[model samples]
Target chain A: MTRFALTVEFDGRPFMGWQRQSHGPSVQQALEDAVHAVTGERTAVHAAGRTDAGVHGLAMRAHVDIAKAIAPFRLMEAINARVRPAPVAVLDCVEVAPDWHARFSCIRRSYEYRIVNRRAPLTHEAGLAWQVPQPLDEAGMADAAARLVGRHDFTTFRSAHCQADSPVRTLDLLSVERVRDRLFIRAAARSFLHHQVRSMVGCLALVGMGRWSPDDVEVALHARDRAQLGLNAPSDGLFFVRADYPDEG
Target chain B: MTRFALTVEFDGRPFMGWQRQSHGPSVQQALEDAVHAVTGERTAVHAAGRTDAGVHGLAMRAHVDIAKAIAPFRLMEAINARVRPAPVAVLDCVEVAPDWHARFSCIRRSYEYRIVNRRAPLTHEAGLAWQVPQPLDEAGMADAAARLVGRHDFTTFRSAHCQADSPVRTLDLLSVERVRDRLFIRAAARSFLHHQVRSMVGCLALVGMGRWSPDDVEVALHARDRAQLGLNAPSDGLFFVRADYPDEG
Candidate 1:
C-alpha cells in the first residue's frame, strides 16, 4: 500500500461538515467515495481539520492509503473526475511517508473569517461572507482581537460542548483588517477548540459595533465562562485556509 | 418630482439580463417593481449597460424618476426592503438633475472578466468565475490585448447581431493581470459593441494558452469579419465593474 497526501479545496455549503456522519453527506464521505471509484478501494481519508458546515477551505490537507501505485497528478485527476457536480476539488496529491497522519502530524492550522460591512444586502458574496448591515469599526475589532492573542485558557470563546481535554491553547496570531466593504479576521494556532474562531469573531464583532470593549474581551477570558461570551458567528464566513507540516519547504 | 441616480450591484445568475424581458424576470424589472412598491408609481429605470444573463455587476449606474419627494438614502432603503430575497443591492443613491441619463450621460464604462486558471472544479467561485483547467500565460495574453487598443473598425470582434451603428470604438485600456488563482482582464472604453468584451476575452484566451500569436489578433482585426474571431467567452465571468460620470464629483 502507498500513502498519499492531498490538498483539498471545497465549498462546505451543501455537506454536513467534514466528518462522515450517518445523518447526511460530508466532505470525508465524498472523498472516500471518490477514492473508491478511482482505485476500487474504500480507503478512509483523514483531514487535518474537520470543518463545520457552511465553512470553506482554500487549502486543506488530507491523507489516505491505497493499494494502487498511481502518479500523484493522475490520482488527483481521477478523484476529481469522480467527485464531479459536487462543490469539492482535490487540488494536489503527493506520495508521503507512511507515518504522516493528516490530523496528528500537522504543525499549524489557519482560518479566516470574512464579514461584509455595508448597508446593502450582499449579492456576489451571498453565502461566502457574514453580512453586517451596519458598518463595523475594524480598528476597534482589531484592538479587541489583540487581547486574545498568546497562550490563554479560551474557555469563554470555545463551544459549550467542546471535547478538547484542555481549554488552554497557544494562539500564534489574531488579526483584523478592513478591505473595501469587507472586514477579515485571520487566526492561526496549532489546534483549536470547537467553534473557537467563530466565538472569538462574534465577541470582536460586538466590540466593532461599540456594544463591547477591548476590556470586555479580557474580562470574558478571565471569567473562563461560556455564558460570558458573545454569540457564535455563523459558519458561512469561516474558511480553513491552510495546514502546515514540518517538512513543507 | 425627484430624479435619483443609484449605483447597483447584483448576482445575475437568476435573472434573464439587465433589460426587462417578458419571458422571465430581469434585474431591471426587479428594481422597477421594487421602486413602484415603495413610491406607488411605476417608474422606468435606465442603466448604463445591458449586461447579458449570468453576468454580474460590481457597480452599475442607473437612473430612476419618482414623483415623490423622498430622501435619497431613505429611498434606497425602501426600495431594497421591497426587493426582498433578490440578489440585488443598491449601494448608493443620490438625487441628480432630471436631465441626467444613466446611459447617455456616462463617459466611460469598465468591465472585468475573471478566469480561474486551474485544473480543479471551482468551489467558492463556482458561479462567479470561468474555470479553465489549463495554465494560462498571462503575459502572453497582455501582449495580445495591447494590439486591440486604440481606434479600429472592430467588425471581427463585434457580435454579428450588434445594434451599434458604428464599429469604430476606441478602447481606452485593456490589461491582463494575475492575482493568485484568478486571471483578471480589465477593459475600459467609451462604449462597446454587443458581445465585444466577451469576444475579446475569448480571443485573448487563445493567446494565453499559446494557441494563437499576438499577430493573429492583429490579423483577425484587419480581417474585419466576425467569422475570423474566436467564440464569445462565457457570460458568467464578465462583470460590468463601473461607469464614469464627470458630474458625480
Candidate 2:
C-alpha cells in the first residue's frame, strides 16, 4: 500500500462540510468516492482540519492509502478528472512516508475572515465574504484582537459541539488590517477549537462597529461562558488557508 | 425636474449586458424598473459605458432624470431597496447640473483584467476571474504591453460589430503586473473600440506563454487587420473599474 498527501481547495458552498454525513454530501465523501472510482478500492481519507459548511478552503491537507500502485501525477490527475462538476480540486499530490499522519503530524494552522464594510448589497462577493453595511473602525478592532492572543481558556469562543478535551489553547497570532472598505482578520495557532476563530471575530466586529468596547473582549474571555458571547459571525467569511508540517528545507 | 448622477456596481453574470435588450434582462432594465417602482415615473437612464455581458462593474457612472421631487438619499435608498435579490447596488447618488451627462461628459475611462495563472481550476473565483493553467512570464507580457500604449490605428484589436465611428484612438496607459500567481492588466483611455481591451489581453497572454515574441505585438498592431488577431479573451475576467469626470473632486 502507498500513502499520498493531497492539498485540496474547495468552495464549501454545496457540501455539508469536510466530514462525511449520513444526511448530505461533503468534501470527504466526494474524495472517497472519487478514490474508489479510480483505484477500485474504498479508502478512508483524513484531513488536518474539518471545516464547517459555507467555509472555504484555500489548501487543506489530507492523506489516503491506496493498494494499487499509481504514479503521483496520474493519481492526482485522475482524481481531479473524476471529481468534475464539483467545486473541489486536488491542487497537489505527492507520495509520503507510510506512517505520516495528516491529522497528527500537523504543526500549525491558519485562518482568515473576510468582511466587506459597505452600504451597498454584495454582488460578486455575496457568498464569498460577509457584508457589514455599517462602517467598521479597523484600529479599534485591532486593539480588541490584541486581547485574544496567547494561551487562555477560550470556552466562550468554542462551539458547544466541540469535542476537544480542554478549552486551553495557544493563539500565536491574531491581527486585523483594513484595505479601503474591506477588513481582513488573520489568525494562526498550533490548533483551534471548533468555531473559535469565528466566535472571536464576531465579538471583534462589534467592537469595530462601536457597539462594544475593547475591554469587553477581555471580560468575555474571563467570563468563559457561552452566553457572554456578543455574536457568532456567519460561516460565509471564514477560510482555512493552510497547514504546516515540520521537516522542510 | 431633478437629475441625479449615480455610481453603480453589479455582477454581470446574470444579464445580457448593460443596455436594455428585447429578449433578455439587462442592468439598464433593472435600474429603470427600480426607478419606476420608487417614483411611479418611467425614465431613461444613460451610462458612461455599456459593458458587454459577463463584464462586472466596480463603480459604473450613470444618470437618471426624474420629474418627481425626492431627496438624493431617499432616491438612492428606495432604488437599492426595491432592487432586492438582484446583484446590483447604488453606491452613491448626487444631484448634478441640468446639462450634466454620464456618457458625453466622461473624460477618461479605465478598466482592469484579472488572470489567475495557476494549474488548479478556480473555486471561489469561478466567475470573477480567468483561469490560465500554463505558466506565464510576467516580464514578457509587460514588455509586450508597452508596445500598445500610444496613438495608433487599432483596427486589428476591434470587434466587427463595434459601432465606433473611427478606428484611430489614443491609448493613455497600459501596464501589466504579476502579483504572485495572478496577473493584472490595467488600461486607460479617453475611449475604446469594442473588444479592444480583451483583444490586447489575449495577445499578451500568448506572449507570456512564449508562443509569440514581444515584437509580434507591434507587428500585429501595425498590420491593422482584424484577421491578424491572435485571440479574443472571454468576457469573464474583464471589469469596468471607474470613469473620470472633470467636475469631480
Candidate 3:
C-alpha cells in the first residue's frame, strides 16, 4: 500500500462540511467516492482540518492509502475527473511515507476570513464573502486581534460541541488588514477548537464597528464563559488557507 | 424630471446580457423593474457597454430617467433593496445633466480578461475565469498584444454579427501580466467592435502557447478577414470593467 498526500480546494456552498455526514453531502465523501471510482478501493480520505459548512478550502491537505499501483499524477488526474460536476479539485498529489499523517503530523494550520465592507448588496461575492454594510475601523479590529494572539483558555470562543480535551491553545498569529472596502483577518496556530476562528472574528468585527473595545475582547477571553461571547461570525467568509508539515521544503 | 447615472455591478451568469431581451432576463430589465417598483415609472436604462451573455460587469455605467421626486441616496437604497436575488447592484448613483448619456458620452471603455493557467479543474472560479491547461508564456502574449495597440482595420477580430458600421478602431492599451497562475489581459480603447477583445485574447493565448508567433499576430491583423482569426475565446472570462466619462470630476 502507498500513502499519497493530496492538496484539495473546494467551494463550501453545497456541502455539509469536510467530514462525512449521513444527512448531507460533504467534501470527504466526494473525495472518497472519487478514489473508489478510480482504483476500485474504498479508501478513507483524512484531512488536516475538518472545515464547517459554508467554509471554503483553498489548499487543505489530506491523505489516503491506496493498494493499487497507480502513479501520483495519473491518480490525481483521475480523481479530478471523477470528482466532476462537484465544485472540488485535487490540486496536487504525491506519494508520502506511510507513517505520515495528514492531521497529527501537521505542524501548523492557517485560516483567513474575508469581509466585504460595503453598503450595496453583494454581486459576485455573495456566498464567497461576508458582507458587512457598516463602515469598519480596521485599525480598531487589528488592536482587538492583537489581544487574542497567545495561549489562553478560549472557552468563550469555542463551540459547545468541541471534542478537544482542553480549552487552552496557543495562537501564533492574528492580524487584520484592510484594502479599500475589503477586510481580511488571518489566523495561524498548531490547532484550533471548534468555531474558534469564527468566534474571534465576530468579536473583532464588533470592535471594528465601534460596538466593542479592545479591552472588552480581553475581558471576554478571561471570562471563560460561552455566554460572554460577543458574536460568532457566519461560516461564509472563513477559509482554510493551508497546512504546514515539517518537511514541506 | 431627472437623469440619474448609476455605477452598476453584476454577475452575468443568469442574464442574457446588458440589453433587455424578449426571451431571458437582463441587467437593464432588472434595474428598470426595480425603478418601476420604487416609483411606478417604466424608465429605460441605457448602459455604456452591452456585454454579451456570460460576461460580467464590474462598474458598468448606466443612466435612467425618472420623473419622481426622490433623493439620489434614497433611490439608490430602494433600488438596491428591490433588486434583491438578481446578483446586480447599484454601486453609486447621482443626478446628471440632461444631455449626459451612458453610451454616447463615454470617452473610454476598459475590459479585463482572466485566465487561470493550471492543469487542475477549477473549483471556486468555475464560471468566473477561463482555464488554460497548457503552460503559457505571458511575455510572448505581451509581445503579441503590443502589435495590436494602434489604429488599423480590425476585420480579422470583429465578429460577423457585429453591428458596428466600421471595422477600424484604435486600441489604446493591450497588455498582459501574469501573477503566479493567473494571467490578466487588460484592454482599453475609445470603442471596440463586437467580440474584438475576445478574439484578440484568443490569438494571444495561441502566441503564449507557442502555436502562433508574435509576427503571426501582425499577419493575422493585416489579413483583414475574419477567417484569419485563430480563435474566439468563450464569454466566461470577459468582463466589462469600467467606462470613463468626460465631465467635471
**TM-score between candidate 1 and the true structure:** 0.98
- The predicted structure with the larger TM-score, 2 or 3, is 3
For each candidate, what's the DockQ?
A: 0.89, 0.74, 0.90
Model 3 scores what on Cα lDDT?
0.95
Docking class of 3: high
Candidate 3 per-residue lDDT, tens place, A1-249, comes to 999999999999999999999999999999999999999999899999999999999999999999999999999999999999889999899999999999999999999999999889998888889999889999999999999999999999999999999999999999999998899999999999999999999999999999999999999999999999999999999999999999987
Give lDDT tens digits, candidate 3, residues B1-249.
999999999999899989999999999999999999999999899999999988999999999999999999999999999998899999899999999999999989999999999899888888789999999999999999999999989999999999999999999999999999999999999899999999999999999999999999999999999999999988888899989988845
Question: Candidate 3 — which residues are off by over 4 angstroms?
Answer: none
Clashing pairs in 2: none
lDDT of 3 at B213: 99
DockQ of the two-chain complex in candidate 3: 0.90
Residue B201, candidate 3: Cα error in Å is: 0.7
Arrange candidates by lDDT, descending. Answer: 3, 1, 2
What DockQ class does candidate 1 belong to?
high
Put down candidate 2 lDDT per residue, B125-232, tens digits, no spaces: 887788998899989999999999999999999999989999999999899988988899999999999999999999999998899888999999999999999989
Off by over 4 Å in 1: none
Q: What's the best-to-worst order under DockQ?
A: 3, 1, 2
